[model samples]
Target: MEHPLPECPIARFLTVLDGPWATLIVRELLTGPKRFTELRAALPGISPKTLSSRLRRFVLIGLVTRTAYPEVPPRVEYRLTPAGTRLQVVFDAMAAWAEQDLPRTGSARGADR
Candidate 1:
């Protein structure tokens, strides 16, 4: 059977956020505004190029805002907009569910060891 398209706004939003590194990037931004280097340090595995692309996409989607400061060395920071801040509710719910339903470690999905 052919798959039906997702019709809900939540589903549509997830499609954008469900991409690799997107959710993690959102989580990091939730804490506060962060510079490029700070986000890179927070998420150890993401490549600089990939992070740059994701930041661009997020800015385009209006979920994130990029601010540049004029200085000897230019500095840029990323922060979630009001629309993006609303997503924290969904993120919190997901985290709560995972904490309760998933095993802490060993043989379970996402277990470190």
Candidate 2:
């Protein structure tokens, strides 16, 4: 069954990428396609279960695609769809904001007034 997204654009975005892992996973995929082991290695401290869960959620939401090939041991690759690639602009904007707006450690810029 298909689920409707929230009316608000921000809410809809949050509904799709609700957690840190979601965006991080997308960021990794933005570089290129990767296998399970590669993704696990790239993201240290992320449990296999969590990675699997997030990938499955991404596949369900149309952000990622999983392709499996038949072979001796079998191989699987995960890649971002066009919709997923579109998130690059959002990530770029976020990076720009963080670099320009967010303060450094111990800086008074972001401190309480």
Candidate 3:
């Protein structure tokens, strides 16, 4: 996202949620923690490399927590931090707006409509 002149606060937030993948990842994790394979299964659109890279960035930024189990067959799960969990409201509002307004504006398909 282009930094809006005059320093907008929402722009800073959008910088972290820069695209569909990041937001969708948050949405998936909102349901609860999930293993790598489960996230992949839930989000088939994202490639393994993209998912891995995005997850690393999320972890670095403290939006996500990664837990690895010690076992012969390792188990790893990704969970959202409290800050990340709060994003569910933002997503819900966005979804509601998209459903109600997008089609009227002819900018996007209103999936709910």
C-alpha displacement of 10 in model 1, angstroms? 4.0
lDDT score at residue 15, model 3, on the 0-100 scale: 68
lDDT, candidate 2, at 10:
100
List clashing residue pairs in candidate 3.
none
Candidate with top TM-score is 2
The ten-residue window of minimal lDDT in model 3 covers 1-10
Each model's lDDT comes to 0.88, 0.89, 0.86
For model 3, residues 49-93, the per-residue Cα lDDT tens digits are: 989998998898789999999977998999999998898999899
lDDT of 1: 0.88
Model 3 RMSD vs true structure: 4.9
Q: After superposing candidate 1 on the true structure, give the runs of residues whose Cα lies further than 4 Å from its correct spot.
A: 1-6, 106-113
**Candidate 3 TM-score to native:** 0.80
Q: Rank the models by lDDT, top first.
A: 2, 1, 3
Worst 10 residues of 1 by lDDT: 104-113
Q: Write candidate 2's Cα lDDT for 1-113 as tens digits.
A: 28788889999999877888888888899999999999999899899999999999889878999999897699999999999999999999988877766756636454454
Off by over 4 Å in 3: 1-7, 103-113
